[model samples]
Target: MDQQRHTQKKLDNGNIHTSPKISTHLDIEVHGAQVYSHKVLEEFQEEVKYSIDTCKIRGFSEAGSLEVTTVRDANRDRNYQVTYCQDTFKATCSCRMLERKGIICRHVIWIYSSNGVKKIPELYVVNRWCKDEIRMKMFDYNGEATEDVDIIDGKQIAMSVMWSEIHKTVAMLMGKLKADVDNFSSVIREFKEKLSLYGSPMNKQQQLKKIFGCSASQDITILPPKQ
Candidate 1:
């Protein structure tokens, strides 16, 4: 038993590894390296630099939220509302750049920096925009033709291709489908027909279990649409 324990310990020690420290514009002096991708980090850094130079914290609410004013022109200053839930670390800005682009905006960057926040709050960093997304093998292609030799995972590559095609189809139909109620309902009905035609012969419960290794009854409860 002692020999077995020693062997296990040795194997564990061999597997132990540490990664290098990454410095970002948010906080280079401390533990601010969790931002993942350097491109996103650089953009945040640029915002921090701009905020330091031109942005100012105008006021704060009793709820611990802040108002930051970004000076675009001397005559036109943009006021951004920043709300940071201290308990949840969920931060949001009124600029809506983060909401639409999945990236935190300059206004929020200034607020975090001013508040002595060394590490970016995890809630503000969308995983989709991070460098780690590539590492995760979520999607492969970047909508570019390349001649470079690279080993591609077949599953991820196929999924990426499928999603690209779906996006194109959806974008083309977006305007016309939303033009009227009948158009929208017709499209949905057609999609349902196609799905039903191609769907598996197995019952919904069995199919769900076979595909996802979980029971539909336990994992999913289909509810009627709200009126």
Candidate 2:
């Protein structure tokens, strides 16, 4: 009986060593990286600003995040912001309104629900690496003819490839810039309309001619509309 008890005690002390380690080196290859975008972050900001219980919004442009605190009452002084992992999407807000019974918050959802990525400062378009589209289209072919050339293949046709690429990139950037300018112009027009309605400032057309030097009511003639 004593020997049986001793054997049991030895087993309890891990003398057999049958237990396994809690951690192990994973064989998985983790291509871990962060991706961020200002556009997405702006969307998050907009969403948070419209959410209930929000008292103030303080965003850091450098860090690419906004801290939104909630007020306990509309006419009170107390405020509380959500606490959650930005990457994990778990949050806690002042009001126990969201799912998880006061664990998740509205601000965090606003950040991600608006289209938040996993990284900071927009890693997808970071400019850290060379543009792949340019590389693929421009450098895809070496231009060296596979067959032997005697310098008499009708001037080699001289594939003007780089010029095409330059033109394309310029066109793309120009289109983007033009769209932004147009949007700005539209916003200005709306503001001018509001001002005119309130009788505080000149009309939209007048304001445009005054500030931008272009008549807001002018006709946009592309080839004069076929005359």
Q: Tell me the spans in candidate 1 whose CA falls farther than 4 Å from its real position.
A: 1-34, 64-76, 134-227
Q: Which lDDT tens digits does candidate 2 get at residues 1-227?
A: 55965764464344223332212121110011111122322333333434333434443222234334343333344455654444544444655544433112334444444344332223223332211112121111224442222242433344445457646655665647678767766876886788787667456667557666676545655554555
TM-score of 2: 0.19
lDDT (C-alpha) at residue 96 in model 2: 57
Off by over 4 Å in 2: 1-49, 52-55, 58-78, 99-105, 113-227
Instruction: State how far residue 62 of model 1 sits from its true place (Å).
Output: 1.0
In candidate 1, position 68 carries an lDDT of: 34
| TM-score computed on alpha carbons, candidate 1 | 0.42
Task: Looking at model 1, report the run of 10 residues with the lowest lDDT sum.
Answer: 134-143
lDDT by residue for model 1 over 1-227, one digit each (tens)?
Answer: 55965774454343233233434445732332344454455565555556556676666665444333332411227666777755555667776878787766666666667667776666666776554443222221333333222455565588679779867766777657456647756877887788887864576666557667776555557788999
